[model samples]
Target chain A: MITRRLPPWFVNALLVPLASVLCGFVVAGLVVAATGSDPIAAFSSLFQGAFTNQDAFAETLVSTTPYLFLGLGIALGFRAGLFNIGAEGQYYVGGLAGVFLAYSIHGVPGLIEIPLALAAGMLGGFVWSGIAGALKARFGAHEVITTIMLNYVAFLLANYLIDGGLMLAPHVSTPRTPEIDANAQLPIIIAGTRLHFGLILALVAVPLVWFLLQRTTLGFRLRSVGFNPTAARANGMSVGQTLVLSMGISGALAGLAGIVDILGVSHHMTDTVGAGYGFDAIAVALLARSNPWGVLPAALLFGALRNGASFMQLDTQVSSDLISVVQATVIIFVAAPVLVRWIFRLRRQQVAEVQITQREETAAV
Target chain B: MEFLSHQDVVGLLAQTLVTATPLTLAALGGIMCERSGVVNIALEGIMLTGAFVGYAVALATHNVWLGVLAAVVAGMLIATLHAALSVSLMVDQIVSGMVINILAVGITGVFYRNYIESSGLAGPDTLPHWNIPGLSALPVLGRIFFQNQFVTYAMLILIFAVHVVIFKTVWGLRTRACGENPAAAETAGINVYFVRYINVITSGALAGLGGAYFSLQQIGNFLPNMTGGRGFIALAAMIFGKWTPIGAFGASQLFAFSDALGSRLQIANVHIPIQFLGMLPYLVTIVVLAGAMGRAVAPAAVGKPYRRS
Candidate 1:
């Protein structure tokens, strides 16, 4: 049988995501066609807009920076068996904190100011997320509900601050904070593009996160708790403490995502700062199967789609909302690998055999 | 500050009912889905689809009931997709629900812009209010309860009816058993899959009715994301109410009261920031969940797909 010859690892790791992505594009094309437009033209222009020139590529990278940080943060939470859905709130609080600090410390040297702002962002996210983590740890309140509630509170807080004169920029009626000082701004990497030092920071995070997850005792404890909390507790691991620590770390990363976007690109905290990156990062993490190393490619893919969407709309008169459709489709396909296998006519693997091996591994552990 | 007059209290109570009706319906729907062992985070998306379809059909057909029927069908279609992915395909329930949400936003937005917006049509007529002659004339109670739109009255009836059905019937027993232990339910000869599918689809239908309330009963027009996280709020309400239909209704009333009060305060020129007022419901939800959720036990099999070995 074809299943006998198939490599299990390739099917599980690579082919599933690839097939899901292809399926997503196909569905998106059909949606475009339904709108009475030429799908081929739409897709061609989407590709062209994403990679046609250095400027466009740079914009894609600019978008990718936040996704990388946010995705890694969410991936970490998933590894620790926590769903930290309040990344949006954390991002908002982080940006607000970073901007507030940067504005207040106006006379500091560049070297000092930059790190201070970034640290403020991380601290803000950590504290914001810690509220939910603490609640979950102490009260057994589900993180999903707490995080979602926190999102609304965060938005309202940001709105209040921006509109009530606390952070509102002088001489402007719009609801936004004052721009960060030049000392706090991240240096641009590309001469004529928005690409900034945030890209380097995001890349640096990848190795650091990878090392922390794969090579540390803390990582082992977190993973063991995630895999089986009862067993981990029996072996002397404190599940509640691990949950709080992992969630705090997750929030810190998301906070960094917010500050990077502000310092690298936006330069000011606005009502729309971090916009949908927190939510989009969930998809990125899911597509990458919550793997830190895989987040780079996944973030890039999402970045390209977002970057290309405006041009797709400009060129074909298609609504940029189509990108959301494609994204949803990808998530559906990826989340249900059985559907992908069935669509591709692949035989089902022996589940009994897999279960026995899993049981054996648990027993050994 | 002057104490609110009797009439003013009645007015606020009436407004609270109007605001709470949609949330009650959606929370009841959430209760049904969760009681059947499915975690339905797609309530927001399902509501959006229902609102869009409900408004579009009402405008096109010039019939509100037909629009409601179409909305329910559209919601069921999305719910079917959710059921297929989460039940048959064994996908992560939360992820499946999130996809449904994103898909609904995209589909509704694209369709509304391409077809509905370009048509240059005005908003549909609002649903008519029903003034029950004898009841509506009966002082403050009458004004608070009887003098409202048809959907508001229907929602009140539904709250009682659903409470009875969920707690007092044999079907309810099997459904609860399925959620608590699907393997045991299967052993007992209950069709667990069928019960889950039916409950989830019915949940979607109720959510669709709630969505129709937004477009038809409240605003007379469908706006993008008009549900505005009400669905999530409803989920919080479900948890807060300990997943009981009547309890969820009570929680919905609490949230709606706060929402109504916030708006009233805004109109009365209160000193508190409007943003802070907007934050009240969410803050209350957090406080309630943290205080009460530790003792709220979820179904053992919730979020887990059952596959017979």
Candidate 2:
């Protein structure tokens, strides 16, 4: 009766993630209390920093841009049943390539330069992740292990290239690449704010990904392979090819995330440009349940947390790392729906049973 | 290259074992958990928690042995969460592990910043090196094998112990049964859930000991993310070794040799860049997984939750 009363969509899309986030807050609040901090005060400051303070919301949007792109990337991978944890490495590689491309060209128009740099970035990410995909398809290698390994490799490679290497800019104290041409730099949409055009690109990417997953033939094939590779193969679909393409596309989005951060925010690629955005994006994608549209809100939540963390630290003397606790708990609750349901005292839905009975009755009729 | 003496080579080999100890421990942990049908990507997180808890306790109590104990207990506690989520609640194993990893980072970072960083407390000393009496007198072999810290000795012992236990014990057979075919294992009157829980917890204990290698044995201070992706490298070693304890040890040694070689080359002022040297272990792991050796397969029922009808 309870299952019949509430719509499945309400229970799933809204109730679950919302309840999980609430649970995450409760868990993190308990941690704050244990650490002798005022949980309520910390949370208030966090909210204020994320929303109400001057330029805070814009900064939050700036933070949200990377999460949005990376979240979409990870979500796309999850749809293909690929656990691509190499986003951090792919991000570094993408940023490196994009920055190199951006700085190499001179006198090019902004319109032409931006897309080319973006493409270079995406291509870099694709190549990095595509190696793992190829290995998996060729030798049955697990993507999880390969991607994680590649992440370290990417970091080292980035470090090598940026520090006293070819990418290091002249007359700069820091170890980083040269700044992109002014034309290549993303224009700030808001006056006197750090927020740039990448936010628009990120926003547009949501529906584009949704359309690709929902309406496109490639999306259907990818999902089918993810659902059951054996069945997909039996149905004459190239499972290997799908896996490779899915990983490449996923990596390209992560690459886009990296390049956008460089062009729009940093204006140059540094070895430390990753700053855990790729890892945080995993939490984002998991929070979204790998749904493209769901990624928007999930990314924003993470963005708000990241943007507000420093303010919370300043106000309550709580460490900014407290956000990670909240993130960890949120992911835990999101992953284990059964645990969430039990905690919330929600009944299991009978949708499958209802559908089964309807099918049987129709057959008899 | 001319500066690389025989003594230097011996020292490098000795250092290689020391570097390999933690990897071998964590890889053994991976072998244990995965052998019992639980995927534990949380080894990195558990090891980090262990290192933090170990250091914190030692700083408070001034007893390194107690610190080691605390680390193991902390790891077990974290793994208990993993078991609860993945085993009892039937959550996706990878997601649960990732949660634990992230949680460890947050918890450790917060505690380190608030208590340790602000207090400016001096950390307890590193674990005492044990020089074996007669064996340490032997020229090259003795120093390489005998002169080491407590964790290194324990790691060598554990490598053999895990091999014997996993291959020779009845419990190990039951654990393998659960991993290979949990439904059949359940039908055979083996408690699949119980086996999984115990193995996963045991794996946590192993990874916890590995965590002590950093804080108690080597560094004498806990740093955030100091485990430095060793947990993932251990996972690769587990897969590369095909989930065997000895094989994991061998793979760990190979990775460790590369790490040690990099440092040795740096000391000798080799032309190779430092970044490339730092990258050796990760690159080797990728190469190993690409099947340059051979195909490595996992247990059939591993990473799947069992349901009884």
Highest-DockQ candidate? 2
Among all candidates shown, the one with the greatest lDDT: 2
DockQ per candidate: 0.53, 0.55
Candidate 2, A213-321: lDDT as tens digits: 8899999998887777878889999988988898889999999999999899989987774489999999899888888989999999999999999998888788889
Off by over 4 Å in 1: A1-4, A350-365, B292-294
Model 2, stretches more than 4 Å misplaced?
A1-4, A350-365
To one decimal, what is the Cα RMSD in angstroms of model 2 from the true structure? 4.7
Model 2, docking class: medium
Spell out the clash pairs found in candidate 2.
none
